[model samples]
Target: MTISQAESHKHLIRTKVWSQLRKVALPDSRFHHDYSSFIADFEGSSAATDLLVSLPAYKNADLLFIAPDNCIQALRYRALKDGKTVLVTTYGIRRGFWILDPNEIHESKWEMASMLDGMERIGRHIALAEITKLPMDIGLMVTGTGAINYKGLRFGKGHGFFDLEWAILYTIGKVNKKTKTIAVVHECQVLDEELRGEVWDTGCDFVVTNKKIIEVEDASKPNCGILWDKLEEGMLEDIEPLRELRSMKK
Candidate 1:
């Protein structure tokens, strides 16, 4: 199938950004830029993390749906320290999710709860069945957009896992238009060119860069829940957690 103009442009931008960052010899040596991930070399991560934590959504949320990203590790730790319940996906939502309760974690192990390996050690794993039952609060979604225009259209590594995550939550009535979704990115990722976005794509309600927080006004977001017809076969098998949710829904 031929790619759309927007997708084509997104690819170009990805290549350009990845190459340029590599030339500069980033602080982190593990550099890899794939179709759906721009991780491991972001420069403005520290400032972005601060900006994200400062948001009211982060401060006030009782239950937070946070993405598993190294850039947002501090946010996770801070949330836990603040006595918030945090829900994070397990590597592509394959193993489902991990729920971290501040009271459950030892004060000394709060750092461990935020790290990937430490998450399994300190947090409780929750399958789709249990996760679907919770009333979600704000979400801190991690995005790897090589380029995003002012319109708030985001381009992922191309796999659309972020969208799928949101769809799953939406299908269970866990989120809605009022849900506060935030993304922390570098100023460079904010581009000038517009990209065509699909309705299923979960656009950010608030964008936090190293410099400031940009509230995306009248942002175009998903109109409905997950469109199961658009899914390929064996999806449930691939994402093990979905298998349970599908069965429960039936």
Candidate 2:
């Protein structure tokens, strides 16, 4: 299928999943828009996080890269409480990346630090060069999904920020073949159909839902770094980290 055709197909799947999630979505006063506009916080988000933390990958990893999605807020809190360092981007990565070191945060503040607004207030913003110099490797990377299939293919909110984040980390050699990737979603978000993923799309090694844990037999991740030619118009000027990263290549 052509790129346009594939995008249309993905849209249909996202619409279907969003519709189902709306019925059981947990009430969050922060959002006023539809589920399609953002990653909706569903009824079983906490349960899914419980199963995620039980995994050997999550237990062994000292550092994690988590997305700033509503559904995975619990995971972020748990990571900090467990004394793990979390690397998170601001919403849409508008402000670039921040590092949340558990040691610096008080135990009473972990819950607040897990939130998006609170993260901005408490987490330390780290520069691209500083990120590359961090001593510890990212052992587990987790992202919230709008929809995912048994094959481990996932679709984000269609903004492509997660894919771009993966590309940046891979380019800097922070994540590699040894890293384990996981997607956390509601059981209703798991679809039965295969998704037509793009070259930049990243897949997961495991899918954790409130219902069960699925280990994808042959899950694949992107090895290529940033495809500068494929970026959206004006993206370099709007995103500070992207702009800095581009100049570094010169």
Maximum-lDDT candidate: 2
Name the regions of candidate 1 deviating beyond 4 angstroms: 1-4, 21-38, 135-144, 232-234
lDDT of 2 by residue, 1-250 (tens): 9988888888899888888887877755666546655687788888899999999999999989999888899999999999999999987777899988889988888899899989988889988889889998889899988899998899777878888888888888899866899998988889898876788888899999988999998777888889989888877777777977887787
Q: What is the lDDT of residue 96 in candidate 1?
A: 79
Q: Each candidate's lDDT (Cα)?
A: 0.70, 0.86
Give the Å error, residue 113, model 2: 0.8
Consecutive 10-residue window with the lowest summed lDDT within model 2: 27-36
**Top model by TM-score, which number?**
2
lDDT (Cα, 0-100) at 5 in candidate 1? 71
List of clashing residue pairs for candidate 2: none
lDDT of 1 by residue, 61-86 (tens): 78888777655777788788888888
